[model samples]
Each structure stands twice: as C-alpha cells, then as structure tokens.
Target: MTRPVRRTRRALQVAGAVGAALLALSACSSSSGSSGSGSSATSDSSKSSSPKVSGTVTVFAAASLKESFTSLGKEFEKQHPGTKATFNFGGSDTLAASITGGAPADVFAAASPKTMAIVTDKKDAATTPITFVRNQLEIATLPGNPDKVSSLKDLTKSGLKVVLCDKTVPCGAAAQKALDASHLRLTPVSYEQDVKSALTKVELKEADAAVVYRTDVKAAGDKVEGVEFPESAKAINDYPIALLKNAPNAAAAKAFIELVTSAEGQKVLSRAGFLKP
Candidate 1:
C-alpha cells in the first residue's frame, strides 16, 4: 500500500510540471500577438498629455509695464514648458506704430485705450481689445523731495526744470490733460519720448521733476520719489491688450493674454501700482 501511494504522488508532481510549462507557452504566444501595441499606446498617451510647442512669441508692450511684463513673460514661459516670450517694451504709441508698420508681434499691450484704438481702428488687431489695467500720472522727483514739487501748481514755478512725455505717448497725454484741467502750464526742459525716459530724466537728476505714470514711479522704487497730485485723478489712463492680426503664433498669443489677465498676473501688476480694469 505504501509503494502504491508513492507512485501516485510522483504522477501528481509530473502532471503539475507539465501544466506549468503549458501556461508559460500560452503567455509567450499572447505577448507576441500584442508585440508593439502596448508600447504604441504608451507613446500615444505621452504625445497627447504634453504636446510640444516651440517658437518665439514677440510681445510689444508699453514702457510703464516693463518690470511687471518682464516678470510675467518669464512666468508664462515656465507654465508653457517649451514656449519662449520675447518682449519689446517702449511707448504705447511707438509700439502701435511698429505693429501697424509690419513688425512681427504676437501681442500688443498699450498703456492707454487711445493707443489701442489706433490699432483697432486700422484693423491691425486680431481680436477686440481688452482693458486690463488703469494707471494715473504722478510727479517723479529727486529722492527726498528735493524739488518741493508737492502739487501740479509747483510744476509751473520759474526755474524748475521739468520733464514731460511727448503728447504722442499716453503718459504725456495724461499729463497734458491734467495740466489743462488744473489751468496750469508747465514748460519742461525736455519732452521725453516715453514715460520711462521721463522718469529716467528725474532719476538721473537731469530734470527737477517729471510727469510720468504712478506705476513707473513705483517701479523705480527709491530711485525717484513719487509726488501724488490731485490733478492726476482727472487723467486716469486705461491699458488695453490684444493679439496682432497677423500673429505668428496665435494660440500661444491667446494663452499669454489669458495668463496676463489671470489673478496671478493681476497681482504682479498691482504690486507695480497698476489698478485692475
């Protein structure tokens, strides 16, 4: 009886080994059937999850928006992975002229609605312009209030070398409106081409005071002291942004505009002294 039991145990072990070999062959055949299918699925998923977008997007923005826009452009590139943003920062009117004159720009951000209107009226914009921020003028003077230019009236004092933006730029236009409303005439030593330049003149001590956007003065930090004047309330400027009619990369342009109008972007602008539109 013991010999018979041992023979039965051996037969069971051999049968188990034969079953395991058959199962291994079955798995190999099934894997061969799907050969490249699993890898193809993984490749498809990767491609869909993160599409590669590579190109340089040029943004033409107002001079007052330089610091904030520069930071925002860097943030945008980080969010989009492979996309790059190149900015051309200058006077709103000058940037508008460049865009209309066939400069390759994916986006245009103006310091004033009037400047944006110039592009929209000519149908040079791809979409309707959106006002993203509002800014007002301030008197930027030498640090520690050396000029004693406390109000708009002080700008008219004799022998005070004042600097103002040319009428073509938004800051200049706002300054002119404010001065006109105050019934005061200010003859600056120089008419700067842009707000940054006007602020620079004051920072360099070349001009006693300059009429520029409040945001510009804030961005300059301790370089120049900003003097708030009541007349600035009468000349608030609205900033607008839009995609160019012939943007080289429309999708990326739209994405960048959305980011700028987002909460994070607003915070950056606000820190630079811009008011949300």
Candidate 2:
C-alpha cells in the first residue's frame, strides 16, 4: 500500500511538471509572434510617414530669373524636407552650354526657347520642355533719363553711348531681332556678357541706355528707369524649363519642376514681372 501511494505521488508530480513546461512553451510562442507583428507595424508606419526623397538638385537658370527662382527655391525647401537647391544663374546660352557639357545639373531654365532648343537638339534634355514664362525687352536708362533715350531708334543717335548684351546671350539675340524688325541699326559702345552687366552699365551711368528684359528693370528698382519700347512686343522671349537626361537626382529634379509649375511658384514669378506662359 505504501509503494502504490509513492507511485501515485510521483505520477502527479510528473504530470504537473509536464503541464508547466507546455504552458511556458505556449507563452514564449505568443510573445515571439506579438514581437514580430509589432516590428512589422513599426516598419510600415515609418514607410508611410513620408516619401523618402533626398539629395541636392542643381539648377541652371537664366539671369533674368535670379530673384524669383531664388525665392522659389527657398519655398521648395520648406515643402520638401531634406532637399536643397543649388542654382547657377547666368545667360541662358551659357547655362545651356554648361548643361550639354555634363555640368551635372538636374534642371535647366532658359530665358528663350532658342537657348533651350540647343539642349533639346543635342538630346541632353530628359523630357519635352515646357514654356514657363515670357519676358519682353525694355530700354533701361539712367534714373533721370539724361540721354533721353525714347525708343529703339533713339539708341542710334550719335553720342548716345548705348550698351547691348553680347549676341551669345538670349537678351542680346532678342534685341537684335527687334532691331531687325524695326529696320534700325545702332552701334553700342560695349557688348556686355549678360543682361545684368548691361543694366549695371546703365545703372552706373556708364552707358546712356541698355536694352534689357522688363523683369530686369523691375528688379533693378530705384537703380534705373525702364522705358517701354513698342518693338518689344515683336521680340518677346519665352522661357522654357526641362530636366537634364543625365541628372544625378532624377526624383528631386522632377519634384523641383512640379514646384515651379505650381500656383505658388507662378505667383513668385509674376511678382518678378514674368508673364505666365
């Protein structure tokens, strides 16, 4: 009777131990499954928080867009976290040449379609270029109009000391076309490298008058006075924007383009005197 009682006691103890071991195994499996599910949820939440777009977007833009583009770039940064804009502002022709030469620019904004054509012609652009803005020429003169430059023809008057952009620049090319349409020939004292330089000459009173974009004159503010020329209508230039084919940050490039075409971007451009395209 004592032996039977001991065997019964041992059997109860073994059964209890086995039950405890099963419970421990079950708890561990449940904990592991819960941990895995929690990890997956965290990963999903991180991915949905924001589109991961980061890197520098280099842009080559025409000198005329300097102020407006600079402002737009700042606003773009606020909209896109971890993104930066780098601008190379200069004559449109020069900028186009740089893009074609593998300057690693993400986007090119040219003052004239002709300048953009140079890039598209070479197939250096990634997509079809779109017209973003239009600008017309204006006669920039000294604050008081001391030389009395009234029109395009007035530039031809002897001793007027006119200044014009070099033919390689967009403004210079448009000025030539306008002059040809008006059947007027004027010899400037100096051919400036860019519109800003030509305007600078007029601002400093170094030149009596210079043909520049209306936006440039607006940007100059009190530095110079702008005289509207009727012939400017015939020489209007359209600005185009496009992504470069070899852009290092293609995603950032496309995002920048979309921002420029947005309503906020247009307002900035309009404030700078650029006509909507």
Candidate 3:
C-alpha cells in the first residue's frame, strides 16, 4: 500500500476509536443523569406523600373524654402552629353513628370497644383501633355523702333515687354488668343518655345517687362524692381511639392520635383518673 494511503487508513482508524469512546462516555453520563433524576423524583414524591400536619382536624369523642381530650387538642394545636382541632363530644354510639353516617370528622375516640366496632365494622376507621385507657364504674353521690350511700347495694335501696346511663352507652353497659355480677336487680330512676348526663344528675342533686365512671366522679370534684365498688373491677370499659377512613385532615389526624397515645397524653389522662391500657 502507498505510504499516504496507509497514513490515512491509520488516521481513520484512530478517529473511529475516539468516536466510539466519546459515544460510550455520553451513554454513561446519560445513564447516571437519569438515575439521579429518578432518585430526585422519588424523594419529592415521598415528601409530598408525607405532608406536614397543618390544617383543621375534626374529632368526634365520647362525652367522658371532654376534659383531657380538650387539653390534648390545645396542645396539639400548639405543637403544630398552623393546625386547629374541632371536637364533638357525645355518647360513643352516637359519635360512631355520626361518623358512619358520613359526618365530616377526622378522628374518633370511643369510650368502649363495642362502640368503636361500630365504626370499624362500617370500614370508617383508617386503621385498627387501639385501646388507650380503661375505666370502671363508681357510685356518685351528693357532696358530703348526704345520702349516706356507701355501696352498690345502697343504690338499690327502695327509696334511693338512683340514676344510671342508658343501657346502650358504655357507662350504662358497665353499670349493668356490675349489677349482674353482684346478682342484684336495682332499678334506676332514670337512664341517662351518656356518662356526663348520669353524672349531671348527681351533680345537680336531681338524683340521690348515680352509677357512673370513676373518672366522672373525680371530674365532678366538690359537686359529688365517689364510692368504689368491688363489682366495678369486673365491668371495666376499654376506651379505644382511631383515625377515620376519609379524614379531611389526614396528616393532622395522625399527629393527634400520636399525641394521645404518647407519654404526655397518658399523664393528662392519669391525672383525670383514667387507667392506662
């Protein structure tokens, strides 16, 4: 071959090799860039999925949870500056019904598992309910024990104007169980809709005595007196809480549940006479 042709051939070969090397480098750089882009997208997606807990969270809770939950709601708002908590406190059954019936609520804190089951059974709970506390029945009497009531049997006395929660409510159900365990059939002058109503009966001196929760009696303080009974141990009510399936403020709802199950929340509950689960 001619020297010129040979030189040209070698130059062509060198140029081809360089071109291939450049193509390979370009491909590697493109692959690396794509990988980084994919990672960044995933990171952004994760951040969006877990948004900050900021918004209005509506909570439906049992009437008995009024005091402590109200306190917790305030603390939750304080922790998350841009958040607000609205509460609807009533009978667990009533609250469960409201939630299942499509009431706009973010959380539910029932006074009993049976009531919470109503929400879960309807697939309205975002997650499985957890028992946060336990409560037992107690006899609440007028301040100073003016009726001289000392025991559950005393509530059965012929002339005593005893009050009790409605049979459907957790407190009433517990009171019934205690009565059943003792083999005593005591008729109440009235069956209150919720624990607070039963407690109110005693607090207002409308009834001589009322079978209510120990927590209710303690909450009443100077307005009523509490008497512990043995049968109460057998009729403990488990209070369960959960986030709703279609929570309006999901992030805030989750944060609120975390707060209620946290150590700080337990302290408030204990101070209110609730037993930890």
Candidate 4:
C-alpha cells in the first residue's frame, strides 16, 4: 500500500472510532434525561397524594373523645410539619351551640347525630357529619365498684349518690333512654354539663356513682369502675364529625378529618375503648 493511502485510511478509522464514542455518550445522556423526567413525574404524583398542608386546625370534640382525638391530632401534626391541631373538649350540645353561634372551628366531632344536626340545620357545617364511632352508656362507680351498682335500677337504691350528665348532652340523653328502657326512675345528685364532669364526680368520691360513657370510665383508668347494663344497648350513641363551613384553615381541617377517619385513627379510637361506627 502507498504511504498516503495508508495514512488516509488510518485517519478515517480514528475519526470513525471517535464518532462511535460520541454516539454512545449521546445515548447515555438521552437515557439519563428520560430517567430524570420519570423521577420528576413520580415526585409530582407523591405531592398530589399528600398535598402540602399547614396552619392551625381547630377542633371541637366531645369530651368522651379527649384521649383518642388528641392522639390522632398529634399524629396529624407529626405527618404535617408546620401545623397545629388544637382541640376544645366539651359537651356535644355545648360544642354544637358554639359552632352554630359563629364560633371559629375547623372541625366538630359530636357525640350524637342529633347534636350534629344542630350545626347541619343551621348550615354551619361544610360537609355532612359522618359517624366515626358509637358509644354506649355505663354506670361509673367507685374503684372496685364499692357500691356494687351493677344494674341501672341499682342507682335508685336508697342513699346512693349518683350523678347524671345534663339531658342536653349526648351522654345524658343516652342515659335517659337506657333508664327509660329499663322502666327505672332515679334522681341524680347532680346533672353535670358533660360526661367527663359526671365521671369526675365519682372519681373525686364526691358521688358514689354516675351514668357516663364506657370510654370515660376506661379513660379514668381505675379511678372509677365501669358496670355495663343491658339497657345500654338500647341507648348507643353515634358520634359524628364534620368540617366547618367557615373554617379559617379549610385545607388543614379537611386533612385532619381525613386522618381521623383513616385506619390509623380508627385504631387509636378502638384502643381507647370506642366502638366502630
């Protein structure tokens, strides 16, 4: 072969090798770009599934839900950084009244459907209230049931200092239904504004016994003992929760409600002695 011909062929081969290397590099760059775009798509999906939520979520919950709701609220704040879950624990009737009276609340969890209606009727609720759990009435007596108050009628025994929740409250209304179902009539020493208050009376030894929700008795944790009556079945109350119409933080409020109704939240409620709705 001539020198010039050999040199030309050698240069062409080198140039072809360099062009092949560049093509391979181009393919790798294109593949990496496509992979990055897919990763971006995945990130977008994740953000949609867990939309960013922040700010304070004010909740008005029934006194019976203090333990479970508070735990769920903490979980929510943990899941959503830069957020606060505040609660107002009180009688369902009182809470309903407040929600209807233009009180600023993100959520309202009532002890009964009737109390929820108090807000729904006035169009104060942004969403229809859903029952998350059901609560049954129980007679809370001194530790170890000192009074031996097992039956609803036992509260009627002479010299028994029993407390009942105010009739306007869900616990009180349930207690009344159970008492009426058993055809029993007993006068309570006091009518507390909420179930917790009535249970507190027994816990303080100020009252021998009180008619309250089973959850309250469980929350008391040996401070008071629970006595289940068959009549309680006749008076199970359904607890309902809803987002408020004028919630200052609607996005956060909705997210909080979703967490409460989620499986994790239900587990917490179940652990707290609440029944599934």
lDDT of 4 at 152: 89
Candidate 2 scores a C-alpha RMSD against the true structure in Å of 6.9
Candidate 3 residue-wise lDDT, 1-277, digit = tens:
6999999999999999999999999999999999999999999999899668888999999998998899999999999898899999999999899899999999999999999999999999989999999988899999889878888888888888999999999999998999999999988889988999989988888999999888888888899988999999999999999999999988889999999999999999999999989
lDDT of 2 at 162: 90
**Global lDDT for candidate 2?**
0.91
lDDT of each: 0.91, 0.91, 0.92, 0.93
Any runs in candidate 3 off by more than 4 Å, and if so which? Answer: 1-50
> What's the number of clashes in each of the models?
0, 0, 0, 0
- Model 1, range 120-167, lDDT digits (tens) per residue? 988999999999999989999999987678899998889999999999
Candidate order by lDDT, decreasing, is: 4, 3, 2, 1
Error of 2 at 67 (Å): 0.5
Best by lDDT: 4
The per-residue C-alpha lDDT of model 1 at residue 100 equals 85
Worst 10 residues of 2 by lDDT: 50-59
Determine which window of 10 residues in candidate 3 has minimal summed lDDT.
Answer: 46-55
Worst 10 residues of 4 by lDDT: 144-153
Indicate whether candidate 2 or candidate 3 has the larger lDDT: 3
In candidate 1 the C-alpha lDDT for residue 58 amounts to: 87
Q: Which clashing pairs does model 2 show? A: none
